[model samples]
Target: MMKHKLPPIYFLHIPKTAGSSLGQLILCSYPQGSQLNCSLSQLLQMSREEISQFKCFAGHWGTGLFSLLDKEISSITMLRDPFERTVSNCLFIKRIVVKKFASNPLALDEVEDLKLKSDISELLKCTNIREMLNLMPSMKEQQSCYLGCDIDLNEYLGVSQCSLDTLDKSKEIFIENIIAQQLSSGLLDINEIFNKAKQRLDAMEVVGIMEQFNDSAHLICNSLGISTPKNLPRENVSPENLALGNLTYRKSGTIPDDVIKQIDELTVCDREIYEYGKKLFNKQLQTEKRKFFWFKKMFKKSERF
Candidate 1:
């Protein structure tokens, strides 16, 4: 008979979701069987014996890694508000891309005349969401200002305003193409992604939210029948950082009113996901309240009965 080995605890690390800090916390908490250096893909490729050795595995797990796991393994993910996440992602890119452009002598000339909307739209054209999702974008492009080789903003900047306008139109078309590809490929539809994620959450013993980090951690501890620690890593977004103008946190970028209308028309799936997430959060809150009340009642009855 084959011995049943315990599955590694997985922390599904989505980018920009405070995953790095969380991963560090998990490693500190379970240093014995923790493995932190490898990617999820690398972990998935390991043999059962190799997998059983690790008590915790934390890394970025993109959608593609979902199918690689066995049913016995527990999975956990931390989700944040999508709109806030999108803004964070945008700011991250800006710091890397825009900051570099600002520092470079040659790049300064181009960025000086750069209108935020046009520049961002152009960037979107060059680095479509499809390429990012597929992990096709080169490491340099991912890190640097240049999006793709074919859609260089540096070259476009030298062109006449008329030419720039044409490029803008082309960029829009490219964005549409990318969105179309996303729709076709099943990654672009937010509702589909959410539903799929929900299924994974149901399979998992725990699902957590960034907003309720401490409560979630306590719940996870109780579920695992482990002694809850007095202190865990606690990192909060500072008030100064939360305010606009801070590099770390900026005011949520406004999707142009027209563009929002267009988005409403184009992405019904995202709307559904937004609604579903809101509903799920509410339901979870109610469940937590009921559990708290029941626990209180049980505690009180234990002394009398």
Candidate 2:
């Protein structure tokens, strides 16, 4: 008899999509340090030999990494409502600035000039939405570029590890090109990215939904035949922190209606992909109804009651 082999797992992590927690959860089933977390800088160090040894890959990787590995891989990912994801990101950054400044406002001086422009404090310091809009190509544009790919970073610029080390363009010019390329392809065209993400998604085994994370986690564990993690719904959220507003900003503080309309226009590509993602997630979930049902029953029991 032949045995089934599960290919290495890759996570297509979109920003603020609850990927951090999911990565932590997926990290559990594999040996420690086997999961390679890729960042923009670290991506420069990525190699076929280094990645092929890992049981899992996570971080801002997308279709681009597919070509680097020696074998085909199974992938899982999650998507959030584009606008909500945007709001959460701004709030998250706002919190970071507060923490960073509270600890050491002087540390701001050391950040790279390009990144410092959108530093959370600078983003909020803008007098109005229009002024803030100017600062965009702000973190929001970076976020959009990440989603623009169904991927991100060097991949977004169509550059690679080898090219990045020697690239001549300033970060500002490179970003301008990223946005220009999107608009030039269409009147804000995304068919190229859209088609790619769609095709890639079709091959994915699990596409989780951030809004329905608890159920999605159940489905992922159920299908993979792995022991489900204990803190089912959210593994690392701090309810007390959120309640105090000590560590986060509110949606109302970050984006108003006009900002949303502007943001909606920018994320039209993501909105299209996310809607399709919803359909795919629901379809995948249906396949594990029996297992998920049993998991749900266990959660429904209340020991205190």
| Residue 30 error, candidate 2, Å | 0.4
lDDT of 1 by residue, 108-128 (tens): 755554425332234444333
Per-residue lDDT over 1-305 for candidate 2, one digit per residue giving the tens place of the 0 to 100 score: 11233347887776677787888777666667777775544554555576678877887654556656677888888887776676555555544444534545565543333234443344445333233344333334333344345323334333443454564423323233445455556644456557767776677778888887877777666555576767854444533224535333324354355666766776676777788888999887776785568778877875536
| Runs in model 1 lying further than 4 Å from the true structure | 1-7, 37-52, 63-71, 98-195, 226-241, 244-256, 259-268, 277-285
Residue 242 alpha-carbon offset, candidate 2, angstroms: 3.0
Please name the candidate that would achieve the greatest lDDT relative to the true structure.
2
Q: What lDDT is obtained when candidate 2 is compared to the true structure?
A: 0.60
* Least well predicted 10-residue stretch by lDDT in candidate 1: 140-149
Name the regions of candidate 2 deviating beyond 4 angstroms. Answer: 1-6, 95-189, 233-241, 244-255, 290-305
